[model samples]
Target: MAGGLLRWPVVLCLLNTLIISPVRSTVWTAGSAAMTQGTAVVVGAAAVSSTDEHFVCATLDWWPPEKCDYGTCAWGLASLLNLNLSSHILLNAIKAFSPLKIRLGGSLQDKVIYETEYPQEPCRPFVKNSSEMFGFTEGCLPLSRWDQLNEFFRESGATIIFGLNALNGRVPLSDGSLGGPWDYTNAASLIRYTVNKGYRISGWELGNELSGSGVGARINADQYAEDLMNLDRVVDQTYKGYQFKPLVIGPGGFFDANWFNEFIVKAKSSLDVISHHIYNLGPGVDQNLVEKILNPSYLDGEASTFSNLRDILKSTGASTSAWVGEAGGAYNSGRHLVTNAFVFSFWYLDQLGMSSLYDTKTYCRQSLIGGNYGLLNTTTFKPNPDYYSALLWHRLMGPKVLSTKFNGTKMIRAYAHCARDSKGITLLLLNLDRNSTAQVVVDPGTAQLSAVKYHRGGVKEIKMGEEITREEYHLTAMDGNLHSQTVLLNGKILDLDAQGGIPVLESVKVDALQPINVAALSIVFAHMPSFYAPACV
Candidate 1:
C-alpha cells in the first residue's frame, strides 16, 4: 500500500478546498504536512554540463484526426490543417516561454508532398488508406496553408524545425529498405519558397526515425550520409542571399551505437545536429506502465542511451550536437490517464533533468498538440500537467546544468541548473516514493536533520537567517489523484484563465537555509537565490 502525508492531504481532498493568498498572484504559504527529514546534495560549485538556449522542445506531428493506436483514436482535430491556430490558449501556451521550439513533422512527413508553384500538383489532405504505409495516402501541404502556419508560428514566437521526406523518389527494396538517391526536387522547391518568403526556420531535419533498424523503412548509413551532403548543398544554395541558413539535422532515430558512429563519421560536417528518439516507457497500453514509472531502476535504464550518444559524439569528434528529436514516454500515441496525467510529469521532468545532465542540447517531447501525449488538451487547447511542467522548466531552469546528487534514497531524483533569469540555481526534485516524504538539503555541508528525524517530522519553515529565502513551486495532482488532469502549484489550482491564458506560475518563499520539503508523489522546483555557483555566476 502506498503511504501518504498526515491528515492535511486527505483534508484538502475531502473539503475540496485550496489555500491561496493575495499577497502574490500565484503564491501560497505551505501549511503543515508530513515530511521526513533527509540529506541530499546539490553540487553548487560549478556546472557539470550545459544545454541549448531553447532546451525545452515539443513536436507537432502530421497525424490527422484519423490517427489511432490500439483501437482508440485519441487525436482529434489537432493536425496542422485543423489545429486552432488562432486559439488564444495555444498562442499563450507557446508565447508563455516567449520562444518554444515546435518540430513540424512526423511519420506522415516522409509521405507528404509540399505544394509548389512550378511543379504544381493537386494539393489535398491526408486520406485514410489502410493499404498505404502509415495507414494514410500521400498527403499534400498547400502553400496557402503553409502561409497560415507560418503566420501562427510568427504570432506565437516559436522556433520551427521542419522535417523533410528523405525517402522521396526511392524505391523500396525487397527487404523494405529505401534505395536510391533522395530526390530533393520537391524539398528544394519548398526550401526555396520558404527562403523567398523569409520564413525563420531554425532547422531542416531530414526523415523521421529512419536510421539504424528504421521504423517503416531503413536507409543505408552511407547512402543517408550522401543524402545529407546533398541536403547541405540544397540548404546552402537555397539560402544563398540569406543572412543565415537553417541547420541540417538528420538520421532522427533510436540510438544504435554502431550505426550512429558510422553515420557521424561519414556524415561529418554535413549534419548540424544528431537527433534520436526515446520511448523508454514502452507502449501506451502496457499494464505495468505506472509501476515502471515509479521504479528507479527502470527510469535510470535510459542513461546508457544518453551516455553512449555522448561517447559517440566525443570519440568521433563529430561537429554535431545530440538532440532527442521526439520522445513521448509511451509510443503508439501514448496512454490516456497515464501519459496525459500528473503522474507522467515524473517521467517527463526526470527526462529533462537526466538528458540535460548528459549534455544533451535539445529535448523535444513527442506532440505539442496532437495524440494522447500532447501537452495541451486536444479539444479545449488547455495546458496539461506536463505542459505546466514544461512551462515551469522553461521559465525557471537555465541552460547550464549543475551536478546534483542524492545519497539518501533512490526514490528521490534530483537535478539542478543555473537559474534561467536569476542568480543562484534551480533544483528540480521528483519524489517517486508515495510512502515517505523527502526533505532535501541543497548542500551536504549545510545543516541537516539528525538521524532520529529520518522517518518522522512535520514540514518546516525553519529560520535560515539573513532573510535569505528560496522560491519553491510545488506541483501536485488535484484530490491527490495521480491521474488527475488538474494540477495544483504551491497549493493553488493551475488552469486557463477567463481570457484563456495560462495561469501565473507563482512560488512561495522559504528560508534559504531550511531543508526543502518535497511531498510524496509530488515534484518541487526550488530556486536557491543565496547559493552561489561559479557556473551560474
Candidate 2:
C-alpha cells in the first residue's frame, strides 16, 4: 500500500460484459474466486465509443391498476392515463437534469387508441377483460388527456418519445401474430394533431414488444417493415414543410438478431433508431434476485445482445441509431423490495456503463415513475436510489465514452468517460464483492499514476495550475441495508426537501495523492479534472 490509500467503494453489479451470448452460464471467465474475494488490479483507459448526447432516458408506462404480476398490483396510477402530472416533486426531478428524456409507453402501448379526431367507438379508459388480449379490453386516450400530458411535459422541459399503437388496423391471427397492412388513417390524424398543437415530441415510436416472437402479440417482419415505411411517410407528410420534425423510432422489444437484421434489411432507411428492451435478470419474482445481482457471470450474459445488435446495425450499412427502448432488470414489474432498493443501483449503473461501451445511443429505464422499477416511488413520488445514480451519471459523465478495461477481479467493474463538464475525464469504479475489498489503480493515457506498484509506465510532471484535488461521490446503502429505499452520498443520507424539490448531489474533494480504496459493496464516481484525455477535447 502507498502513502495515500485508495479505499474501495462498494458498487456491486453483475455487468454488461463485452462478450456474446444471452444465456446465463455460471462460468466466470474473470475468476469467480476473485469475485467472491476481491483482488488488486489496474484499469486502463483510452479510445472513445460513439455515444449520443442524450444517453439517459426513463419510461412512463400505461399499465393501469388492474395490471398485476406475481399476485401484486404493482402499478398505482403511474400510467400515462392517470399519473399525477401536477406532482411538483416530479417536476423538480425532471428539471434537476436541466433536461431529461421521457419515453411514454409500455406493454399497453399497442392497445392504446389516440382520440385526436373522435370517430368509431367512444373514447374511454381501459376495461379489464381476462378473455381479451393482454387481459384488458380496448382503451382510449382522449385528446383531453393528450393535452394534459403535453402540458406537463412542456412544463418539465422533458424530451418526449411517444409509443403509438401499431396493431390498430391489423387483425389478430394464429400463433400470437398480427396480419394486414397498418391503417395509418387514425394514427396520422393523431400525429397531425400533435403537430398542429405544437407539442414537441422528440420521437414517435411505432410499437412495443411486437417483435422477436413478441410479448403480447407478434408482427411479421415483412409486414412490420411495410408498416415502418407507412409510418415514415406519415411523419414526412405531417411535418411536410417543417424544418425540424420528431424522430421515428420503433420495434421496441427484446433483441432477436435474426428478426432485427431482417427488419433492418427490409425496412431500409425508414427507421431512425432500432430500439429494443432488456429484462436480462429474468422474472422479477425470482428468489435469487440478490444472488443474480451479485454474480459476475450472470451480468455478463447480456453482452451478446448488445454486441450482436451493434454488429447488425453496422453490417446493414443503415444510418440508424441503437437505443435500449426499455429495460427493467427483472420483468413482471420487478421485485418489490429489490428493484426499488439501493442495491438496484448496481444493476442500473452497470447497464449504463456497459451499454455506452457498445455505443448505445440512448437507454430508457423501464420507468420514470411506475411499478417497483420506477425511478420515483409509486405513490409518494419520492426519488428512488437509481434516480440519484442516474442524476449523478448525467451530471458527471459526458457523452464521449472512453474505452476502459480492468485486468483483475470481475467483482470490480470499471467505466470511464469525458467528464460531463470540465477539462478532463471521469472514471466510475464499482465493487460488487461484499466481503472483500479490491485495491486498484487507474491508467490515464495522458499521465500515469505515479509511484504506484501497478503503474503501467507513462508519467508526466505535475503542472502548477492543474486541479490537484479529485471530486468523488461515494454511494452506499443507508444503515448498511441494501434493501433500504434510502441512499447515502459520502456517508450522508440523500433525501429531497419539502415542496417536491431534489436535493443537491454533493461530492467530497480528496487529495489526488491519496490512495483510492473502495470498501465492500460501494460505488465511487471520481471526476479527475487534472487528468487529461484527448477525446474530451
Candidate 3:
C-alpha cells in the first residue's frame, strides 16, 4: 500500500441506515500488497498459500510495429497516445514508449522488415513500405529508430530482448559463406550503438513462427537447432568487440510441443529464453470460444504445455524463462472491431491475472496500433477498448497479486494489489456481466478502511474522437466513456465535472462506505486511504 493522506466525504445519513454490528476496527496501513497480501492476508487468514495456492500475473511480451506514413511512422510519435485532442502530436510514438521486447520475428520478420516480393500472393494495391507485396526489402535498419529505441527503454522502465532476423533472407549460413549477401554487419553496428548509447538490452531472439506455414527457410528441428547455435556464436563474436554478449532468444513460434522438446534437447546452450505465441480464436464469441480463451481448463492446458517445455529445458541443462511474444484477441484482425469494444476488458484483465501462473516473463500483444488487434485505433490514434483495460492494469495492478474473493455471485472479477508506491492499497474489481450491476460487499479483512475512490462506466459502448466536457475542458476518454461526474473529498465538494474538455469523476480524496454496489460490466478502481495500510486479503 502506498502512503498518502486520502480524504473522503462522510456519508453520514447513508451509513446510519446501513450499519449492522460492524465492529469499529482501526485498519493499519502497511507495505507492498504483492508480498503482504499473500503473506499476511490469504496465507494467514484463509489458509490458502499453505495448500495449492499459486500466483499468476501477466507481463508485456510483444513489440508493436511502427506504422509508416510516406516513410514517417505515426501512431504515438506526435503526442500522447491517449487519443485525446491536442495541438501538438508526435512523429515517433515508439521513441518514448518502452515495449516489453523487440521481437525479430521469424515468419513475419521477412514480410515486415525486408519487403520481399512473393509470387502467388493475393493481389492488392501496391504500396511502398507495405509488407503485403514486398518482404524484407523495406529497410528496417534505421539508426534513428534504434536511437529512439534506446531512449525509450531508458525513459520507460523496461528492458529490450531484440530478435535477430531469421526469415527467408535473414538467416545466417552454417558454412563460412555469406550466401544471401545479407548485411549482418548493420545489425552488429546497431547493437554496438545500443550499447554505446547506454540502451539496456540483455537478450536477442532469432526468429518467430519459424516452423509454421512457409516461414523460416523450412529448416528441420535438428537443422534449426544447429542454425541457432551458429547464429549464437556469430552474434557473440560480432558483439564481443564491444564487450556485450546478450542472451540469445530463440524458437519463437507457435506452440509445437514435440518440436520444442526436440529443439530444446538439440540447442539448449544456444538459447537463453524460449519464446512462443498463443491466440485463442475459436470461431466467434460463442461459448466454446470464450471457454477456450477464458476457462481455467484452457489455462491448465497452457500451463501443461509450458511445464513440459520447462522440464525439457531442465533435462537439456538449459534453464531460461519463457515469453508469449506476439498475441492478441483471436489473432486475425482481432475478431473484427468487436475486439475493440469495451466488453473485451474482461479478457484483458483475465490475461494479466493469469500471466504469473503460466510463469511467463513477458506477454506482448500483436500491435499497439494498426490492425483490428491494436489497442489504439490506427487512423485517429485513439485508445480502443483494450487500451483502458491495459492502462488500468498498468496503473493499479501492482507488482504483487494479492489474494481476493468475489463473495457473492461470481459475476464480478476482482484482483487487488499492494502498491509499490505509498498510495495506500489499490483494489481493481472488474464486473464482467454486461447487463447487470453487481452488488459487492468488499471485506478487506482486518484492515480498517478509511477512503476509497472509484472509476466506473458502462462496459460496452466505446466513445471515439476528441471530447469536450460541459465546462469546455479538453480531455480524452479511454474505453469507458465516463458520465455525470460527481466527486466529494474529505467533506469538500470538488468541482470535477466536465471542465475545459477534461472529464472528471469522483474526487480522489473521498472515503467510501462499505457494502459498495458496483455497476454492471464496469471497472472500478478503488484506492484505500493510507500509505501502507493493514493487510486486506
Best by TM-score: 1
Q: Which stretches of candidate 2 lie over 4 Å from their true place?
A: 1-46, 118-120, 173-176, 445-459, 463-467
TM-score of each predicted structure versus truth: 0.90, 0.89, 0.60
- Candidate 1 per-residue lDDT, tens place, 1-537, comes to 121232221111113344331111223324335556555566555678899998999998888888889999998988877887878889999999889999888888999899998654678889999999889998898898899999999999999999998889898777778889999999998998988897899999999889998988899888899899999999998888878888999888888999888889999898999999999988998989889988999999999999999988989888789999999999899999889999999999999999999889999998887888999989989888999999999989999987777878789998889899898788898999876767676662232333111111112222222245688899988878899998999887898889998888888876454567787898999887666565687
Worst 10 residues of 3 by lDDT: 468-477
Better model by lDDT: candidate 1 vs candidate 2: 1
- Each model's total of backbone clashes: 0, 19, 63
Q: For candidate 1, give the lDDT.
A: 0.83
Off by over 4 Å in 1: 1-35, 444-465
Best by lDDT: 1
Model 2's lDDT to the true fold? 0.80
Model 2, 434-537: lDDT tens digits are 76655455555333344322211111234333334677787888777789999988777889886668988887776453334565687888787765555676
How accurate locally, in lDDT, is each candidate? 0.83, 0.80, 0.44
TM-score comparison, 1 vs 2, better candidate: 1
lDDT of 3 at 223: 59
